[model samples]
Target: MSKRGKVWLGVAGLVINDEGEWLVVKKSYSGLKGKWSLPAGFVDEGETIDEAVIREIKEETGIDCQVKGLIGFRTGIIRDEISDNMAIFLATPRINQPFVKSERELLACEWRTPKSLVTDHLTSAMLKEMASSTPHETQFCVNETVDPGDIFGYTSYKLFF
Candidate 1:
């Protein structure tokens, strides 16, 4: 069986706090409602991934950030039943700005210690990734019986430091 492919481009931010915690948002909309994950969203056409990341951060957290470096990439099946390619980037919050959660995209936004996330409710991959100090590469097809090609199209992005 061949999987029907659909391409998706997304950006995620690894925002760090003074306490060494990471900023994450609790999605309240479709797809992954109530699930804890990094602040992220789909990239608009003609929009650079870096722009998307910064925009998403402000939309979801209402804070300005400076991109630091590429954290890594995460490719997997989303609850929408589509394959998603996400580029994670490390970011530092700008000084003297407060973040207000956007009720449209997030129900709550908070800073969580890396260690706290490991024990609390979080995406399995997110928890594991946070536990590691070094960048890692990982790929897995959910519902293994489905063919990768038929499952989704590959979306690509360029990383900017």
Candidate 2:
């Protein structure tokens, strides 16, 4: 198969509440429309992955979050797109607040347990890795580096890291 001539680096956050549920979103486009997955999107130039995670969570779920640690990264090759890389980080909300869904872009928002989400056919590899790992005692065996893409209206965000 041939690549789609595009490069992309996406950042996603695994924000769990006191109840131990991860925040997920229904994306509106970019091959993920109508799929329930972790809240994430393309990172921008001059934007750190941490900031992207925080902003993406807020924008998608309307809940403020802070990155706890970098869990790890996962790489995948689409059938016709450039090979993809997604960095998944651990996060928590600043305040114990519930989220309200956005009126645009996202179709819905909900908190789900890892066991239920892991086997989903619609689940992306990024989320599956996070769900498969033990939250407190995970091991990092490798390092991954990736480049970012240019998606219009996708701007860098400032957040508490």
Candidate 3:
């Protein structure tokens, strides 16, 4: 890896409904506009990955959800310089409500069947795989909610298992 490379942490959520449909969105901010994908964004400083995933899902889809566990993650080098790593989380909605897409951040928001998402050409490979598989099948990791004061001097620390 080059010394000039930087790593960016991101989060995505697989928000599943009782009907087994997954929530997804189309980005409106960049060239990726019109492409369907899981609601995802860069993790903000001072925020945990699970918190980031929940926030992203709410901001993009307008549906509140709680993180159940982490299903998986993906890491790759962008242009051989920037390192991109994303954590995929399994979550469920907290209330029965409709999803309102953010006009500035999303082109569309809708529920998609696992098969539909998996077959869609516009969906990314990781998103497709996550949609097609369940958390149990993927061997999910859960936040152990360890105390930061006990483990480290940092104000905030999260350990997953």
Clashes of each: 5, 0, 0
Provide the lowest-lDDT 10-residue window in model 3.
147-156
Q: Which candidate number has the best TM-score? A: 3
Off by over 4 Å in 1: 1-5, 77-82, 122-124, 132-161
lDDT of 3 by residue, 39-156 (tens): 9988887989999999999998899998998866666545445666778888999999988889989988998898998789887545665656565644645433332122112333
Q: Sort by TM-score, best first.
A: 3, 1, 2
Candidate 2 achieves a global lDDT of: 0.69
lDDT string, candidate 2, 1-161, tens digits: 13324666888888889889888887877666666678887787788888888888888889998898987665655444455667878899899786777778787788888887888766654465557666556455542322112332223311111
- Against the hidden reference, what TM-scores do the models get? 0.73, 0.72, 0.77
Q: How accurate is candidate 3 locally (lDDT)?
A: 0.74
lDDT tens readout by residue for model 1, 79-139: 4466667788889898746778998888888887777766675543453344444344322
Q: What root-mean-square deviation over C-alphas does model 1 reach? A: 7.0
Instruction: Supply the TM-score for candidate 2.
Output: 0.72
